[model samples]
Target: MIREINFDGIVGPSHNYSGLSLGNLAATRNAGHVSRPRAAALQGIDKMRSNLALGLVQGLFVPQPRPAGEWLSDLGTTIEGADRHIAANAMSASSMWAANAATVSPSPDTADGKCHLTVANLKTMPHRSHEWPATLAQLRLAFAGDAFAVHGPVPPAFGDEGAANHMRLAPSHGEPGVEVFVFGVSGGPFPARQHVEASKAIARLHRLDPGRTIFAAQSEEAIAAGAFHNDVVAVANGPVLFAHEKAFADRDELVAQLSASLPHFELVEVPDAEVPLADAVKSYLFNAQLVTPPDGAMTLVAPTECRDTPSVASWIERHLASNGAIRQVNFVDVRQSMANGGGPACLRLRVQCDPADVDPRFLVDDAKLDRLAKVIGDRWPNEIASDEIQSQSLVGAVVQARAALLDALELSELG
Candidate 1:
């Protein structure tokens, strides 16, 4: 029964383009543009449906409450009184990127034979720092069974950005795996969000074997080129590691180490000559979801932008034509998320576990997606302009919309 269930974060009604993420070029570039929350959420639901059609298990996380009223109160101000930057932080919906939710170690790789999840502190960004508590609440509920163990955020002194910076290479979902934790020492032009110390601490917390665990430094050049998190430049699934040429600080050494440590390991590296680093980051070619479907060849779930970018498109065609490790390429539209520096890979947190052990409410089906879409269409705002973030009317609408989703889901403790 053990399988990989991708838990995608539901796009919130407060989703906007305030450019809260510092190193993410897409978010910064589209800072003032209008956002379509309804469209965004629907798009996410459709993405989940697409995965389900591919015979992949799919789960969901409700959006964290916005206007983060309590967080704002601690800063000695309310949403209306806060400055534009602060106000935007208060209403940020960055939680939609579930990849940042937690670092998951499947039961097969853990010492106790139970899956472990450590919520990310996300201390680098003011808007994201307060997310752990809400994220922890959801994880606790979804994985309450004995087959799972959910840990709180690591100490704030060490920054941890979760699964977005972590990857596992294994023979299968139910087998012991080699886990890699990628951290940034210095982001160069951008701030290094994941600390090496934090990554090591998580390894201990999960009780992973020292021999099987790895701590890799993210490349400064890559981060400087807008590859903020390791996920932006690489992704791992099954025994394959798909990455850009400059993803790691020490690419050859890391590959040598991985090849020596893991069996049946395959590397699908895209040389910068084929697709330059700038274009790779812009098109999110490496951020694509690398998955092994239940009944099909290994697949790459990438964004439409990758298909549109000339260099990236050419590379993908060649990859497909060669019968590469990624046998199928499926393109999905998440422009709403893409504009904010998140792509298909960013939208999900992969958990390898038995479906029966997980809370059924978090799992979704086509019928359930239909219901969720109806709620989104009826309640989610059609558009969110930058200037309207502070309007009491919009705040009320956003708050009400979340409540409606919670009521419909029937398990929310009120995010």
Candidate 2:
């Protein structure tokens, strides 16, 4: 009975929005589009969708606090109000509303049966000190247990260090049993020497994995060329590889190491597209989330542009119908003003579901729980035979066992 799970969404400041009209601001800053007014309107729609999705997922949607000042007054006020409104709606929808806290990027940690979150702080440009402590504190508290393990934002041996925007961690892959492997920057925009030091820190950490980890070094020049931005956006499973064409000069050696040590490893080649790497990555991640299968097969949903561009939709439709188990993948006509992109899974994070308890046929209605129980009983007749086990006795045992597990985990204190 996993009741609570934490997840982080990218939300914060945008310096590029400065001095622009709301429409122009969103177009230039958020969507990177030419139609300023349309983009602004779309931003509103995206925000609403983001809120609804977070609410549905029963997870916290943490955003940076509104910055003070007249210049950002209107935008800041709107975002603040939106956050409160969404949170209220979410609470009303679920009795299991856990907790929501504001912070910049959170530190990474793992604890048995609980997820920890760290929000990215965008207020203090390029500085780690402003929000790291608070982020770390929240993560520590959320994942307080003997099984907790600190994983990311690997600090340098000496001096202050900034956290990387992209890195690998488990749970992100939805693979519970695999060893966590980390990659990405150790420091910030720099003299390259700092990156070397950061790389060294990663190398030391890599040694901890023996043959189980792989580090793909993307050159400073490539990262500067907008590689890091795209990589971060595209990451669905693990760390974004920021590599130039030549960066894989040591590819064979790396592959050999990965094959020897890691349960899985592969170097992915990114396509050269007109869109910014970040945007491309966003689109990739968006699609990935849209069509995740229960059996873990990779599937792609119909493209959003399918209505106007049938050619693109047909390809995905054919693929899904012929190769994948997707029952259907229709292009949903969403309000253009939303802040969230992607369908279904992209918007709603799956918090908890018992494989033994979940009934695929379960419906959402007043009698949903009862229907689910009935379906489970039908599916596993032997496990619930009336002659062998009385219904009341089973219920009592389940309730007692749940209470005992909660007590052992000390979740009562959290309440």
Candidate 3:
């Protein structure tokens, strides 16, 4: 049986707003503010539960160890001896945004008919560059069942940011689909995170049909305005592609190509007049999670920030009233994550496959969620001040808190 499961990363105890992600407006604006790690994790959990209540399958990925020992050592210092900035970046729980987790090819789309996932290299940012090894370890353990095939990321130089740069479109979630890989060149003031070569290599590695795959470059304007990842400017759900007018450098050509391949698909574009590229970035309108359930109209799960933005919220209302596959809009409060440049969609990765093919330890049921909520509430810090990043006491607390979280989920092996 085919299913779409959302694997959300368990927010780490070290969650803080360091503004390390350069192209992220929210991160830059809230650079040194205090963060509520416990609230952040629970907010994510609440979003997961909401999806589950809507009859969606949900799963979890254990957080990677923070203040990564290996990274500190690479810098020729131990965690205790590292500078405050280094320590904060090392312990950043940015991995909680699983959209950058990996690029997945469902069974029906790959040549082998076995689900394939390649962990992202994330070489664009220094703090995130060290995440792949740890992410791969977790992917291996979670998808250990025979039905899955997991691969390590491409070499560091190509600069792959995984699924955030890739989107799948099909008549149905279970069918073989068209994969659109969005890459960008560095011509803007801000760095273009996803490289064209990396996207192509990943498509080849996944063995997707060349005829069904398309490569498109993100617009320089979007990248310069903080659309670092393609997901920040465009999102796809089944056959529907919701995007901004300037999302791609060659929008018309790309749309023509997509229409040729997926004739029946719909393209819902937000023109610059309705919401400028800068406004879109500021509101994260395109960062919303678009999902088509098994038997209902498509739904758009947007962050509360969208509703707060007059232009974005108005545009959404107007768009929904007009005509499109997206019938309903649900706003979720993920302010903590939004402050770090990730919205509702950034917190989870969507995998279309059978649930039984995954490790039960990674799946979520009401019982497991209850336990997770309890553990997060009990252990996660209520406040994490930026200045406290160097405190030995705070570091120790974060370490112990993660240990307790892993133990709660019976995932001590991740430690």
The number of the candidate with the highest lDDT is 1
- For each candidate in the order shown, give its overall lDDT on alpha carbons: 0.94, 0.29, 0.88
> Given candidate 2, what's the lDDT at residue 19?
14
258 Cα displacement, candidate 3 (Å): 0.9
lDDT of 1 by residue, 1-415 (tens): 7999999999999999999999999999999999999999999999999999999999999999988988999999998999988999999999999999999999999999999999999999999998888999999999999999899988999999999999999999989999999999776669999999999999999999999998899999999999999999999999899999999999988898899999989999999999999999999988888889987599999999999999999999999999989898999999999999999999999999999999999999999999999999999999999999999999999999999999888875755
What lDDT is reached at residue 26 by model 3?
84
How does residue 209 of candidate 3 score in lDDT?
Answer: 94
Cα error, residue 114 of model 1, in Å, equals 0.8
Quick one: best TM-score, which candidate? 1
- Go through the candidates in order and give the C-alpha RMSD of each one to the true structure: 0.8, 15.8, 1.1
The deviation in Å at residue 21 for candidate 2 is 19
Give TM per candidate: 0.99, 0.43, 0.98
Ranking by TM-score: 1, 3, 2
Question: Which lDDT tens digits does candidate 3 get at residues 9-107?
Answer: 888899998889887888999989999999999999998888887778899887888788898988998777888778877989989999899999898
- Give the worst 10-residue stretch by lDDT in candidate 2: 91-100
Mark the 10 consecutive residues where model 3 has the least summed lDDT. Answer: 288-297
What lDDT is reached at residue 8 by model 3?
91
